[model samples]
Target: MNEILDEMNGHEFKFIYKTELFNEILAMIEKKKISMENAILLLKCIGYYATLKGIWVSDFERSLLKERFEKMIKNEVKKKEKMNENLLIDL
Candidate 1:
């Protein structure tokens, strides 16, 4: 059916796939093999590319994603700061 074909070719699929890739990147960051900043940068870049390619993410959804990524990066920075402080204390 034409409707089914249209649905399959829609932006929803692209958004879902992007979200999954973002989650995978987060997992890699959690495992300490990559930095949170790096992950966020990659996500943003990819999102921008997708936008240019006609993906339709609303401003609200983009804001939410940005907020979550910023929070995660802040947490990582705080963690590293605490670690350095503890190292100083130990020294």
Candidate 2:
């Protein structure tokens, strides 16, 4: 996965929704098997990987990608807040 992400500069990134890889990434984030920072890094790079190289992505894929990643970020923040609350309660 790191290799894929590292090589992202040359990737087409034309169809972010083309495979189940996105779902696997989200699952890794949810399971805390991957770092939140890395997830955010991937999300940030998606557009640059396409836009910088002039790759035309479809509207459907763009919208879906935006919606899903935004949702995952929000959920992560909420979960972190809840966990912090529990820690405070213990204190």
lDDT of 2 by residue, 1-91 (tens): 5456445543435444343656666678778898756765665565455566666545434444346656655665688845544322321
Scored by lDDT, the top model is: 2
TM-score of each: 0.45, 0.47
- Candidate 2: global Cα-lDDT? 0.55
With a 3 Å backbone cut-off (N, CA, C), the pairs that clash in candidate 1 are: none
Ten consecutive residues with minimal summed lDDT in candidate 1?
A: 82-91
* Model 1 segments more than 4 A misplaced: 1-18, 57-91
- For candidate 1, what is the TM-score? 0.45
